[model samples]
Target: MQTNHDHSDVTVRRDGHIAIVELARPPYNYFDETLIGHLVAVFEQLDDDASCRAIVLASQGKAFCAGADFSGGPTDPQMPRRLYRHAVRLFATRKPIVAAVHGPAIGGGAGLALVADFRVTCEAARFAVNFNRLGIHPGFGLSVTLPRLVGPQQAAMLLFTGKRIDGRKAVEIGLADVLAPDGEVLAHAVALAHDIAASAPLALMSTRATLRQGLADAVLAAVDHEASEQEWQVRTADFAEGVAATAARREAVFTGK
Candidate 1:
């Protein structure tokens, strides 16, 4: 049996005990406030449905998520704060999530993938924490999630360098749990979700809740610090240089000024 739901930028479908939540933007799916809100709503609904024991989070795009689309949004200072407010809600979800990371997951995009309990990726997948490269502090709770996943040393390396690593390297560093063959990432993620779903649902949720206890609060706290830092960094000359260099696909020349 199957059931489907369509949101503005996301799709939710159920196949027996596994719920499939897919980001619908094509090419490079750059998340913004609306997309994140839709995801939070979908996860909340799935959490209430006893039939959904687990979820496979995938995307219809060359990049799982490139990051935020900063070019078009309202330039209001409160925009990112509003977005992170919803992001914290995503971390509060109850069900287990397996993220199918087929391509680049950079900056906040990487944070989205980290929201999952497990990540399945292919060699084609690339992961990076690029906030420093953008002359901003990491957001989406990456300051908490990245270090928790990869250990502080490895997380610091990725954050400081803003270098991208392929799926194999990501797994080696504990950033990804499973590495699937190219083109089979989503399939592997769904299979993993099904395996989780096959377990007794009540026990699974109970275990998951215990394991993830205090995580949402930690993320919320980290976001507050991150947002505070980014608030000042966004006003720096280095930020302008970084943005221009990124757009031109070149290395940034940052001056401490």
Candidate 2:
């Protein structure tokens, strides 16, 4: 098959019924537009392949994903299209993809983790939708998925407050299904995928499909809310305060604008 990805930073290898895709941006696998498109295409192909029984999502880095590359100066004209392309993978894929998370999965990072069918986080992992801290709105259907995992009340608190918490807390809130030792996340996910591979493929497919029917549309609606809330937050005094505090390494005192 012809592949459409930058394998230098990401790699895919298949062994029997297990397929492993590793995000390889070292130090932090911060996603860019190119990377997002590549991943969407990869997941699309995996969903179509009959030989592939299960997938393990792992990363080679200190942080699974630190979110988007924020070092570049703000305001990219292609931000939405780029972001939505990434969102497409999270929403459209039909296969069972399990994420093995370590360190910080913040901003877009958390979205990537949430899209997986199952997630295994190490003791050191942290999850957050931190666009409020960045003075940007959340993207990637988090408005729906976060709430679905932890319920509306908790979701609102996480979003409005921009809270980030460790892996155990993530599992406590239903964001992670398994917790493992540091650096052992991938091996654990692969083991789980092996177990999933033992199940009847058709049955697994049907079960997942039946459960996911309205999920895409619902998440799209939540993405709209993320944009609205994010836009408003970006315009508030809180945004400036957050940004300044982040730069100065201090806690922000939000006025609830």
For this target, which candidate reaches the highest TM-score against the unseen true structure? 1
lDDT of 1 by residue, 9-88 (tens): 89877778998898999888999899999999999998999989999999997999999865542235566678888999
Best by lDDT: 1
| Candidate 2 weakest lDDT stretch, 10 residues | 72-81
Q: Give the C-alpha lDDT of model 1.
A: 0.89
TM per candidate comes to 0.96, 0.87
Which pairs in model 2 have colliding backbones?
none
Q: Write out the backbone clash pairs for model 1.
A: none
> Mind giving the per-residue lDDT tens digits that candidate 2 earns over 1-257?
23334467777888677788888787889898777777777777888899787888878879988887756434353564446646755677777888999788988888888888899997799888877676667777877788888899988888777788899988988889999998788889999998998889989878888888888778777666665555455556766676677657787787766
What's the C-alpha lDDT at position 212 in model 2? 81
The alpha-carbon deviation from the true structure for residue 124 of candidate 1, after best TM-score superposition, in angstroms, is 0.6
Candidate 1 residues lying further than 4 Å off, grouped into runs, are 1-3, 72-75
lDDT score, candidate 1, position 172: 94
